[model samples]
Target: VGCFHQPSIVLADTDTLQSLPKREWNEGFAEIIKHAGIRDAAMFEEIEEVAQGVGDLPALIQRNVAIKARVVEADETETLGIRALLNFGHTLGHAIEAAAGYGGMLHGEAISLGLRAATWLSLQKSGLAAADGARLLRCLAAFELPLKLPADFDSNALLDIAAKDKKFEQGAIRFVLLRALGDAFVSCDITAEDMRAAILHLHEPV
Candidate 1:
């Protein structure tokens, strides 16, 4: 149930919902791996197996829940942490969503691409290692997520939209970039050079 003024979740045709799995879940994994990372090779292997549909999702979720319970019990703080994760790939993804006129691409599609851009920038500017970045790219590719921005997209327009991102603080746009797998940081000091490079990388294939 939602808040008093909140609307109910919309139920779509089963076939339509099944067909749009990429749109629904790509953004989720984009956020999940941002915080979880491929730090443990075993975990990445599990993810790969799951991607191949040879692994069990319920078992994996149960395992993750057990792991999270150690760090945080059921509480508001835990809820906040979950929301924070939801925002992992949203920084740049929101800009792409706006620039593309909101519905041109799937929500997960935009976030998946945004995750790639942010991860690449993090490797250079935020100390996310190259190998870790490469691992993330591999996973995104495996999921069929777009790793680059469309050639016709204008970087300047994206930046302009980025400036309006709700995560901005005191007029400076803030970004969440991984410093390494399983660790991420928010920074407002990202440079114009990095921004330009990220957009260009998005336009060009890696």
Candidate 2:
């Protein structure tokens, strides 16, 4: 199906989610967290409040759907910058997954690490406050998500892989960085050195 053919129906079955193992459930939360991080500070707080449990899966899923639906409705074809905000952690996330040979880490796990790296970058160049990044990290920690690069992870290799991300254009890669929780914007002026420093920062002990 082409971009014009939107899905006829979308469904969220909480019962199915309720049956997943804890690890799998947390994996799904990574995307949910990403959505909240980029679009709604209040939503992020709600998620953080329930970080240890999925007793409200139905409501949580609904909220996640609503956030994404709003973005999609506004930019169905991704021509508008609004839609690209959905890729908040995916550029670095995808590169990490590729460098890990795809199965070394779960997609969400890689993304969780990507989120931290992105936040660090945001603090440096996007005016994201240190306190905001700390708050986000605490939320991620509550879910036991990864916050650092894997052992023996190669920063140079990851950078090489990131350069191949689909978001790259005109010899620069576009990144979604948060100026504050729930406030994200795309910037293509990030230097390669800054990106490398962000990756390295993730490897440092918190």
Candidate 3:
């Protein structure tokens, strides 16, 4: 048997993935969210450390090790599961951003908003504790991730876009819910009306 080309691996010593293009920085960050087990304080501390000195390659790569582990452990079934988790906030998120067009919002930023909405739903459907939801909200805020939809976005178009996400099964969209930090599961029974209400409520002021 012959192996073709080099295996893609994220270097634990280097701050970057040698095989990955520089343009994929955000793509790398996308893996960060899945490691929900890491405390928010440590995660933000790493972010701050990176901001202070991007030249510290070792520390940056160390922070991303768990992400690499997940990817390395990925098989067909687990890969799909991870990908599905990544799509958590993507339903309404992608549509709002696409309709608003580029320069309006970054992809991760939009998805962050979606994550918040999904987490909100998780609280209702998956027994997510109030403290966990609050912590998630705070962590997203610390990362400067969005927690609300843009004011100009159209609700129906967003819903249509979300509906088209492949996570939908038998015509119902499935969502990943966090039962707690470090634990998440998926379900499709959440109604659109409730989802939309959650999104809308997140946008409203106290």
Instruction: Provide the lowest-lDDT 10-residue window in model 3.
Output: 33-42
For residues 1-206, could you state the per-residue lDDT of candidate 2 as single tens digits?
65465556678767876687787777777888898889988776678668855546678778888888889988998898999999888888888888889468888888988888888889988899999889888877788888888669999999888877777776667899999999999998876777788788878876
Q: lDDT ranking from best to worst? A: 2, 1, 3
- Could you give candidate 3's per-residue lDDT for residues 69-182 as a string of tens digits? 553456334445654554556666676667667787777677667677777788777887888777666656555566666576677776777667666676667776677766
**Top candidate, metric TM-score:** 2
Task: Candidate 2: give its CA RMSD in angstroms.
Answer: 1.9
lDDT score of residue 198 within candidate 1: 81
Best by lDDT: 2
* Candidate 3 positional error at 18, Å: 17
**lDDT score of model 3?**
0.60
Clashing pairs in 2: none
Q: Which scores higher on lDDT, 1 or 2?
A: 2
In angstroms, the error of model 2 at 15 is 1.4
Worst 10 residues of 2 by lDDT: 1-10
- What's the C-alpha lDDT at position 20 in model 3? 64
The candidate, 2 or 3, that scores higher on lDDT is 2
List candidate 3 stretches off by more than 4 Å.
1-8, 12-31, 37-65, 68-72, 77-83
